[model samples]
Target chain A: MIPLGYYIGLSAILFTIGVVGVLTLRNAIVIFMSVELMLNSVNLSLIAFSAYSGNPAGQILVFFVIAVAAAESAVGLAIIIALFRNKLTVNIDEVNILKW
Target chain B: MNLEQIAFLILAVAAIASAILMITRRNPVTSALFLVFNFFIIAVLYLFLRAQFIAIIQITVYAGAIMVLFLFVIMLLNLGDDKLLKWKLNSAKTISVLLGIALLVEVSYFVLHFTSTEGMSPNAESIGTVESIGKVLYLNYLFPFEVTSVLLLAAIVGAIFLAKKKFE
Candidate 1:
């Protein structure tokens, strides 16, 4: 059996990459993708703990998380499409009309 | 170093590499494709962890449904290669990279130092199967399951409302 620490370490690395992507990337869709990456990393950790602790609650929580992520991405992409129709660009820096 | 360990290493490397490529690529479509690949690798990792139901759901929902939606939006926008050549090593990028490194070091330190006192349950193998997940999900988590369905419905309506063309 693989050590649980290895799984946790992998999850952390992936989460950090997702954070970096969100911080550095300017495209709205890519940022959204990075958010999904973060969510997946969290899911991986949950499953790792589930496997290690032999609990079903963590897996069930992962199910809920996947459902929530799917819904979030649907609405988020729709909003992105709406934004694109108005701005004709997906760059985050250029979509600062509401900023002071 | 057994087969499982080797498999875990391979999948972990593939997932991290694909995620990095996904974030770094300039073309949104290319990035989306790499994200799909990353999702697949993650699904396989779930399988290795013996969470078969989640593995299947990860493949179907993430790689299949979510990626398709992303691709559709990418093509709909018809984004060109204009943004591809604009890569810059700005202050935000530098700071974020440093912060990300810090986050990785901190997390790995915790992961390596911490040890679990409780042993895995003897029934760990049986808990992750599809039937067991279904039983627990329907019995104990039925309310959340119903709420998820409602949430999905709301998302569908919201997507339609947001994306519809306005007729004035």
Candidate 2:
């Protein structure tokens, strides 16, 4: 049977993949994309929960999440670009000038 | 499993596989492209859940707009050959893996315990339709909606500030 559990399981797995990406990937932009993936995965779970629980509030939360994700991507990419210009590199390991 | 279940399973597998490729692939652009495919598969999954509005928004916002932004920046910076794999798992990796295991256990527990009340409900039809969602979204949730817009504005300002080379 097609169950909500299946959707929830898939969502959880996808979110885990995104988390793995964020923790492992070195490129700044790549990490940002992983963050986006994590956000999308969370949205999937939220909407699924909303559909199953008869709550419209979850869908509204999804709307807010999408808007915020867009904004985050913009600012994050800009920061990455600025860092790239400063170091001529996009690798996070090398851009640790602020590190003691 | 039924046909719908099979289909969803296939899509889920595809999306996860591509996500794996996204993080592991050496080329950054390829990784971004894989992410775009992952988004498409996710949008299809959303359709299966009967959230037509969300599926459309997923395509438009994630597949259409955000991906293009990533591609534009990647191309603008000419980071085509920026592929260098970092060896050894950092502490963050260990923590993330543990977190994933915990999430899996929790979700599986809920799945095994809770019985689904069947597919989409009759009321769901009217509640989340484009018309109704818009009505409630703008009326009852008007304050939070406006606040979200302000957040977007701030993000845009932040982006411009970060992208600029100098303050003067």
Candidate 3:
């Protein structure tokens, strides 16, 4: 029998790596990918805890999360494309038209 | 310490490495490819956990549909090497590192203290199978599940509005 800690620890490590990617990467596309990674890590943790607790609720939640994540990526990439077209760059620093 | 564990370790390492490469690669196409590879590895991990339905959904929704959408946008944007926006190491890196360390420390403490060391009863029956999951979802969480579909519709409309060309 595998321990829940093992799964949770793995999820934590993956989540940290994703958080780092979101922080350090400047490319908008890469940041989008990092967000997906973070969502996947959450799915892992949810599934692990669901297995631990013997409840299907968490798994259902994971399903909802997956749906939302897919939709989010679609919208995020679309917005990125629009921004890149108008500004000719996806770099966060140079395209700051909203800076107050 | 068995084959399953060994396979999972390899898949996890591959996934993490591909994810790192995805962030660092200069070519957007290459980065997207690496992201796809990473998703496949994650699907393998889900399979190892005996969540076959989720594994397939991971591949279909994330790797298949979402990535294709990303690639479509990348191509549509026709983004090339823009010298104006180069990625550089910044002061934010320090803050992120510190934050990551703090999160790791907190998770470790929780893992060590809050949770018992008890192993879950290996669910020999179908815990994550599609049929069982669908039954439970439709029966108990039916309303929320339907609401989630509505949320997807809202997101689609929102995305279309955000991407529409503006006329002056």
Candidate 4:
């Protein structure tokens, strides 16, 4: 049996990548995709802990998280579409209308 | 180590590498594709953890459904590379990358040094099966399960409302 630390470490690295993507990337869709990556990494750690503890609750929570992520991405993408329709661009840096 | 450890290492490497590639790709479509690959690897990792139900859900919901939505948005927007290239490496980006690396190092330190006294239940192997998950989900988690349906419905309505052509 592998130590639980390995999974946790992997999850942490993935999460950091997501954070860097969100921080540095300007494409709105890519940013959203990075957010999804972050969520998936969190789910990984949750399942790892659940398995390590022999508790099903973490897995159940992952189920809820997945459902929420689906809903969030649907709504988020729709909002992005609306923004694109109004601004003619999906780049976050260019979409700033409230700056002034 | 054994097969499980080896599988974990391979899947973990694949997942992390794909994620980095996904973030660094210039094209949104390519990035989304890499994200799909990352999701699939994570699903396989779930299988390694014996969470078969979550593994399947991760594949179907994340890799399949969510990625399709992302691709559709990417195609619909049709953003040009010139527009995406507006942002360059600035101070904020450098600091963010530094912070991210620091966070990773700190978390790894904790994870590597931490110890737990609780032992896994002997029946841990069976907990991840569909039947077992279904029991806990429907019995103890019935309320949250129903709430999830409601949330999905709300999201659907909200999305349609947002994306619909303004009739003004």
Candidate 5:
């Protein structure tokens, strides 16, 4: 069996990458994708813990995470679309104004 | 390392590569595709970890639905050839990258130092199956499950309200 540390290490690396993406990327949609990446990495760690511990709790948490991620994405994308329609720009840099 | 560890090695390499590709791509569509590929790799990794049900849901929910939604949003926006836009790596980018690296190092140090030597539990192999998971989820997590439905409904309403052409 592979060591749990390996999985957690991988998850950490992936999470770092996602953080970099969110910090550097200007596109809102791309930023959203990066957030999803971070979430997935966290899920990896959770599953690894659950599998090693033989606890179903972690798996259930991942399930809820996935479900909430789904709902969050649906609403998040809609918000992005709405923001796009109003401002005509998806670049996070330019959409600075809160009120028109 | 046996066959499974070797497989995990290869998949980890591939997953990291695809994840990097996903972020580096200028076009959001390409990024979405790479993210989908990364999700598939993670699903396989789940299978190797003995998480059978989670692996299936990882593929179905993440690679299947969320990514398709991302692709749709990308296409609808038509933010074509984002490379043409000037994307300079300012001090913020540098700081962020530095911070990310630092975070990775910190987490890795902890993981390496605190390697759990405990043996796997007896039911560890079968614990990830749908049958076992369902028993716990339906019994213990039932309230949360119902709340999740309410949360989803609220998300649906909120999405429609936000996206409506003219909100009254």
Candidate 6:
């Protein structure tokens, strides 16, 4: 069996990549994708721990996470589409009237 | 390294590469496609972890359902051209990258330090089976499972309301 550290490290790296993407990428859609990436990394860690601890709880948790992610994606993408409809752009920087 | 180790290495590399590609692509469609590829690789990783049910869910739900929604929105918005997109090679970008690397280092250090070398549980195989999972899910976690259905309903209604062209 591979060391548990490997999976955790991989998840960390992926999570960081997702964070960087969210930070740097300006497109709302890509930002949403980055969010999904982070969520997936969390899933990886959950399953990793679940397998190592011989517990199915983590697996069940991941199932809920996936369900939540599905709901989030549907709602989030709709919001993006609505924002696109009104603002005519999905570039996040441009949507920052709230920032000022 | 054994065959399993080798397989893990390959999958890890592929997953990282695709994630990077997904994040960096200028075209949203391309990024979505790379994300799909990354999901497939992660599903294989889940399989290796003995989470057979989660692996299938990752494929069907994430790669199948969610990605299709993403692709649909991308195409509907006609966002193909990104020439005038707001991205630039500047200070904010550089600092975010540095912070991300710093976080990666911190997490990896903690993981290596804290993780026990004791690997896979002997009973991991049995617990990961669909029947065992269903037993626990239905008997123990029944309430939360039902809650997800309600949550899904709310999301569907909310999405339709938000996406509609105008209110009557």
Each model's C-alpha lDDT?
Answer: 0.89, 0.82, 0.78, 0.88, 0.89, 0.93
What's the distance in Å from true for residue B154, model 3? 1.5
> Residue by residue across B101-163, what tens digits does model 3's lDDT show?
888888878877655677554672377799989998999999998898898898989888878
Question: How does model 1 score on DockQ?
Answer: 0.69
lDDT of 5: 0.89
TM-scores, each model vs. reference:
0.95, 0.90, 0.90, 0.94, 0.95, 0.97
Best by DockQ: 6
Model 1 chain B: worst 10 consecutive residues (lDDT sum)? B79-88
Q: Give Cα distance to truth, residue B40, candidate 2, Å.
A: 1.2
> In terms of docking quality, how is candidate 1 classified?
medium
How much DockQ does model 6 earn?
A: 0.82
Which prediction has the highest TM-score against the true structure?
6
- Residue-wise C-alpha lDDT for candidate 5, range B1-168, written one tens digit per residue: 689779888999999999999888888888899999999999988887788999999999999999999998889889886753345788988898899889888888898897686655668788888898899999999999999999999999998988886522
State the local distance difference test value for candidate 4. Answer: 0.88
Position A84, candidate 4: lDDT: 78
Query: Mind giving the per-residue lDDT tens digits that candidate 4 earns over A64-88?
Result: 9999999999999999999878887
For every model shown, the clashing-pair count is 0, 0, 0, 0, 0, 0
The C-alpha stretches of model 5 lying farther than 4 A from their native spots are B83-86
lDDT of 6: 0.93
Candidate 4, residue B62: how far the Cα is off, in Å: 0.7
**TM-score: which is higher, 5 or 6?**
6
Say which prediction, candidate 4 or candidate 5, comes out ahead on TM-score.
Answer: 5
Cα lDDT of model 1 by residue, B40-73, tens digit: 9988888777899999999999999998999999
What proportion of true contacts does candidate 6 retain? 0.85
